[model samples]
Target: MGSVIEREHSATGSMALGQWAVIGMCMLFNMINGLDTLATAFVLSSLSAEWALNGFQQGILLSASLIGMASGSTFAAPMADRHGRRPLLLASLLLSGTTMLLSFWAQGPWSLALLRALTGIGVGATLVGANVLTYEHASLRRRGLAISLQSVAFALGVSLGGLLAHALNETVGWRYVFLAGGSFTLAAGLTGALWLRESFEFLAVKSLPAQQADHRPALSNVATNSPVPSLASQRLFGRGYRQHFSTRQWRETISLATAFFLVMFCFYFVVSWTPTLLVQTGASETHGIKGGMLLNTGGMLGALLLGLGANRYGSRQLLLGFLLLNAVLMTLMVPATQVLSLAIGMGFTLGLLLNGAIAGLYILAPQIYGTGERASGVGLVLGLGRLGSILSPVVAGVLLDAHWSSQALFTFYASSLLLAALAIAWGRGGTEERAGRSRN
Candidate 1:
């Protein structure tokens, strides 16, 4: 009886620790992955003024990173399945940190763009690795919840970048902002190295079921739907996944990718170019930047609340509500800028609704595919989404180049969210399959 009780207690402890480790590590990685990237955007005005860059040039600089992200995201998932999650994630984090440090050495727009591209590559790799690992680590009962927490990390990192850039730009210089963010990534990576263990599922891929049957009896019950392939070729493009790479899958990928693309285009446009937009609207640099940073804070709030809420109520409804709310708040941003409180409130609400809803898309993408094709399915979705993000800056720059009114810009943003809502609403026809392996 004592032995049974002790075994039960050990099992409970392991379960709790696994949940915390997976969620907490992924969140921290999310924070590090985007911190320097976001800070660069906040400091772009200063860089432009220092270098005499036009709006189009600035947009090109922004596009450089997305270009790398698009490429990197395409390959990251396959490598994660091919090798394993932890090593690749660690490498991505290291690359992100190193690339951030290199940004300090950039002398002009072209150089900065090159460095930014490298940073984007690192972010793409990290994102793919992080999401796949989080899904592998989480209990089936709470997989959605674990995945959504990554959105919280994204908001936190963005907010931190904005605040840090705003606070330090006046005193330490914009380069210092990159350095600080980079240092944080290095530190976080080191901590992760010490604490993070390989996911049990990844280990299971290498072990025979019979060999795992004695002391590791728990491994015997791993769900077949979880795709425990020992080889990458067996999992991604395997016989079981031929349908996933077929015409039907391509159609689904395109539809969802386009909707996600629209959403991200709006999101990145607001995030990457908002400071420029606000400054163009006759707000002083200080007020414009302060307002821009507020959006990230709002994003963090929305992601945390809606992400957890979706776990209870369902991702579909949460996504619809958040997108509709985003449309409403974005429409208000044009007039609300006249009042400080109202403008900040609108920015916050917009961030929360927009990012939180997008987070659900990330969770849903993997679910839409069978276990055998999970990595490829997610990679394609995010790759297409990055293309949307890539185009956002150019589109916004064109509007600004043509002297579009702030109201007009905001209107475009609002309409995009509405379009995204319509797409999601009309395209909700798929069945979801459970992943095969549980993290524990």
Candidate 2:
């Protein structure tokens, strides 16, 4: 009996060893996910010209995608909680990739917008599933590091998309970009279908004792602190649990949501209008695209460095520090333009910090909730954040239409970063310890 137990432990250890490999594979999926999310930004100008779109139309397109993304976030979290993580993720990847591939065939702006919105749904769902998978598999000490690595993967994808678009858009055409980007998602989906395993925790929940007489599983494997109420019994607002968004939880959620709004607002604005900004500053479309690529590269580097810092200082300090740096870099966007290298360098710095801060939010959010409520909490926060994403492009369009100077654009972005800094400060308290306890 003792030897049998020892053997089981050995097998568990071996299984864990394979998790690192799985994590690496998941990173590829993360990259593909980022590509799908940001590809629209790269092609916005081309689409505007080809379709003869106005600022309002652009805003509508951006908002449409964001609304779909929010729908995914709102639904997928509960699904992941009730179902399992791996299955939902696999489905998300396939659906998202297929939708993006279909976008290439759209005949008009409305069709393209619909397809893009569907793609956003896939992207949004996949983001939550992937983050949960990676974070849950990680040790408490390394949780922040794991999340940071995912951010790096995302930044790398977006950066590469920018660079690739700059180099190939003239030769291959914009539709090809969509096709190529979509292909990555297809590859990731196939890989996941072939290699991904159900999470052990999720499996343990499902494998709970069966009813011998009925020959069926007795209870659902989904985690929850409260009793499993019927669909009609479940209530989000009523006194369902001991703590329904206590003061601390509400503050944490609000702070994170606000930070997400500001960061996303700036991020989408840059993604949608970088090319236009470059042109306004007297650069070619190619130069503008390259600058976008440079910014992403900077972001990737920042995520890598911040991942290391997360292991040392915890995600909280790292987030605050990064937010401050991002504010400074964003404010300097106009002045740094005189020297192209300075502009690129500054953009890179901003990207790094931006990616890290956002990643910090993902890492810390799960720590704040119990196992049962985790998915719902994460879902709600991300859903609200999508509202920010929805607003960002619209705001950018309005500013562009107002004939705002390039300097004014940078200045506006700077204010968002400053607000993020404040939110980060407000959210401080017990996050690292909470994360550690969740792992135990």
> Model 1: which residue pairs collide?
225-436, 226-436
Residue pairs that clash (backbone atoms under 3 angstroms), model 2: 299-351, 299-352
TM-score of predicted model 2? 0.81
Clash numbers, per candidate: 2, 2
Runs of candidate 2 exceeding 4 Å displacement: 1-15, 44-55, 162-173, 204-248, 272-279, 282-286, 400-405, 428-431, 434-440
Estimate the TM-score of every prediction: 0.81, 0.81
Residue 6, model 2: lDDT of 37
Instruction: Please report how far candidate 1 places residue 345 from its true position, in Å.
Output: 2.1
In candidate 1, position 118 carries an lDDT of 83
Q: Which candidate gets the maximum lDDT versus the true structure? A: 1
lDDT values for all models: 0.69, 0.69
Off by over 4 Å in 1: 1-15, 49-56, 166-168, 205-234, 237-244, 272-285, 338-340, 370-372, 401-404, 426-440
